[model samples]
Target chain A: MLPFARVTVIGLGLIGSSILRATRSAMPTVRLTGYDVDPEVRGIADRIGLADDIADSAGAAVIDADLVILCVPVGAMGAVAAALADDLPADAIVSDVGGSKESVIAALRSALPEATIVPGHPVAGTEFSGPEAGFATLFRGRWCILTPDDATPEAATVRVRDFWEKLGANVETMTARHHDLVLAVTSHVPHLIAYSIVGTASDLEDVTQSEVIKYSAGGFRDFTRIAASDPTMWRDVFLNNREAVLEILQRLTEDVTMLQRAIRWGDGDALLDLFTRTRAIRRSIVEQGQDDAAPDFGRAHE
Target chain B: MLPFARVTVIGLGLIGSSILRATRSAMPTVRLTGYDVDPEVRGIADRIGLADDIADSAGAAVIDADLVILCVPVGAMGAVAAALADDLPADAIVSDVGGSKESVIAALRSALPEATIVPGHPVAGTEFSGPEAGFATLFRGRWCILTPDDATPEAATVRVRDFWEKLGANVETMTARHHDLVLAVTSHVPHLIAYSIVGTASDLEDVTQSEVIKYSAGGFRDFTRIAASDPTMWRDVFLNNREAVLEILQRLTEDVTMLQRAIRWGDGDALLDLFTRTRAIRRSIVEQGQDDAAPDFGRAHE
Candidate 1:
């Protein structure tokens, strides 16, 4: 059964485009309409036949929709929500796929005070961006966390949950603040570290940029994949999840300091102890099907 | 033509076994022999017929070999070299695949002062270890850096370069100290950061370990692959390459601090700029064929 019959996706980027494609594949009878502020992206969506209709504006997009899912950056969520507030149907349920839930939920609530809002975060994406890079299976086997405050109606949250499950996501419910903290640890800080290290490698005096790129297969290349993720999306994530991100970064920095001391003292046992313990986490990630078990990310060597 | 008629490999771990497998495929007619300190590993090599002959001892392995490659950890190179010295042929050239070149070169020189020493570090590996985890194509299209000192004969360096080239690697020569610093930026320091962060995440009091593992697909999992690398090998690398790794790590920490400040102050422009700059490097890595261009390292999404 289709949980959402007439859905409006109000951002035609990677996540939004993926939702359109996934909906088309999963529930063909449901009417899908896509809208984007960028004319170029809208053109691409239209050219690609992304949905049943391409709306000229956000308000027009949701005029007749029963569900509206905003796929914009966390920092822009409020503005987008406010822009579409006037024309949104009175009974339509609003949702989002922002990375940070607390800020997103707050922004969404302030913009659409009377609407039934369910903020969600699909913990899945690639380093690539834009409409062309997304695929229908992007959310398959991935987790989607939804944050709905006490004021949100239970029926609206369930419908949103059912909608995601139709698109192959495993849905879980949590408070916005807790969701933000969890995502800050799992996503934001790791991206910040990746972006920071890549910058460090490129700006080195002793190591030529050419040399760094050449021998990157040694280890630096792994960071590059995550570092290459969409800049605006990541920037908003850090800004919106500021407190939790900073807390985790501080913890990581202290841990790194301890390791620096271990290296300086030539304490092989200390270094070995940490290194050995980390292997168990990696094994669990693979065993749980969160990652590929094949060596080197299953990259082709030949 | 084969670079060496008889090649001896000591240490039947991932790199050593991979060397045996790659050599067998690249130079089918060359005589091959392997040895390891662990009798169990030697037995595994013999049962698998990893080489033409699996020597029972280090001395016996290199007695008639024209080329003896020490495929052991950096800290063990000196003692292994001392063990094989008495039986090594007078003209045999000694080389090593240790990650740190300068310390390894110094260790080999003190143990076998008159031997021709060519230190090498391959810019390729997987998280998996042990002989059974290796494959013949592990070195294909990878970089193998050789650090041979002025005192070493050019012919010895050339022969080692030729050997790696025949095994489908691109060979580059540089001074041992320079190689150490370059690798500190490219490999060693990157590894230290990965190990440190994984330790940090696993030790967090508020975030459950199970939650971290489940949400790892959000980027935490990327760090785990490198963190899971062989602990003994990495411990020796950080210990022996102490100066270079420490220098690069300090630089990375400073860069990370800058990112932390940007986040603290909500400097979206600065964060976005660094994130954008990093994407260019990832592009360069892909353009140079250093990494797979496919999104998410070409992982299977479904």
Candidate 2:
């Protein structure tokens, strides 16, 4: 009853390796193959036996794959698709775990004309990257957004959805443009802001970097965990999802400016009102099982 | 030898109740008392036996205590001290757990001119507020900073330091001004930005609030934990530490603007450089034991 009896994962990074592990754990009878652009990564995958086969090249990896998931950076999706185009099976259902979908979908369509494409983005990750940092449980209980265009066949989308559901993800479908905007607010810009603030904290002349690290438990440490996200993946995300990310970042800047004014003018009520309102969102996020209800994200105090 | 034989914590909120619980756990024989202006909080504390006594008034809370720690909002520290001034035992040392030290020191000095004072800030907390949310291990492995001015007796500072150490905190001494500046980057402004961004995300017209909550796991949830901090406490912090918070905020805004420009102009290299550099800070935080080394803050996936 496997949706993908023979699966191939390209760009064997965190998400790719994770899909391999999850498939191995969930549908062991199904064949799993993985490939990375870096030979070192492929060697590591081989050493770990991450899949039934760690293919030497993209073309060989997808030649027999019923389902092919491109797990490289969004900016590299087209190139990866192009690399495997001639060898890919005509009947193969192609999907991806890219953050930004509009650009990725366009790139993929250009490289794989007439291919069944259903791009997806799983809303879960640790800051760590590379093959070793992934886990079988990463996609469990998390949302995996699938962006399937008009040209994509319903059967292909359903197979991709089933593939994710079998791996333990809740699937939702949306247009690539809407997906980009929603993710811009929730994921892409949040990472960008986290990165920007950490950079700002480190560059401060008055507050030594040591002090920032020591006292980070107050709030900055929460950001450091996020600011530590993979650089190449995130850089490509910003570049690919430019319009939506810029739009959300502009709104955030405006809101922050309003807060700055409130702080400068000693408007405690304005500050308190906004702070109080935001708490309810956190409550809803927890109540909806999107985040841990445990205090401090369940951080151990002792 | 115990540094404090009798401790009174006025303001039965998260930090205040936590101090009482930590004291009971670490120094069982010490006399403890607590008070809050909110009758409901005081009743909850009394019902739970949070301390040896739940005083009805701030004045009655510290009448015979050898140490009094005001754990209310920074803006209320002066009022709490003035309320307890007439009944405060002459030999008692007063301290506070305020985010901004310089203003609190001024307020306490003005309210209790003849009293020995040591101002402290515990760089630790959960997003939850009020008595029932506190626990004995709240301060374990966190930093407690004491800012005692030249006019304050050294013995008073030492006694406060010893008290925090007994509660399993590492104590450090610094000037109140320096403490404010340090926390501005590490804590205050970080909290402000978190609160601001959460507000921004919730107000997005294109994206439904429900969508934001469901996809929050990506990175926004990391911010919600911080944004969920007590409004009254954070409001007072920003107002009291305006100068330092504003200075740090300006730097963060400028850095974010640079990032926006980079993203808009497709400067992936610039974004990658900053994102890569920020990862080192996250590593140092883990190495220093300032934050959990667990990936995704050790959030459970299944």
TM-score of each: 0.99, 0.99
| Model 1 misplaced stretches (Cα beyond 4 Å) | none
For the second chain of model 1, what is the TM-score against the true structure's chain B?
0.99
Name the top DockQ candidate.
Answer: 2
**Candidate 2 lDDT by residue in tens digits, B127-197:** 99999999999999899999888898888888899999999999999999999999999999889989988
Candidate 2 structure quality by residue, lDDT tens digits, A1-302 = 78889999998888999999999999999999999999999999999999999999999999999999999999999999999999999899999999999999999999999788988999988998999999999999889999997898899899899989999999999999999999999998889989999999999888899899899999999999989888999999999999999999999989999999998999889998999999999999999998999999999988
Q: Chain A alone, model 2, TM-score?
A: 0.99
Candidate 1: tens digits of C-alpha lDDT, residues A1-302: 77889999999888999999999999999999999999999999999999999999999999999999999998999999999999999999999999998888888889999998988989999999998887999999889999998988999999999999999998889888888888888888889989998999999887899999999999989999999999999999999999999999999999999989999999899999999999999999999888999999998898
Q: Pick the candidate with the highest lDDT.
A: 2
The segments of candidate 2 whose C-alpha lies over 4 angstroms from its true place after superposition are: none
For model 1 the local lDDT of residue B202 reads 85
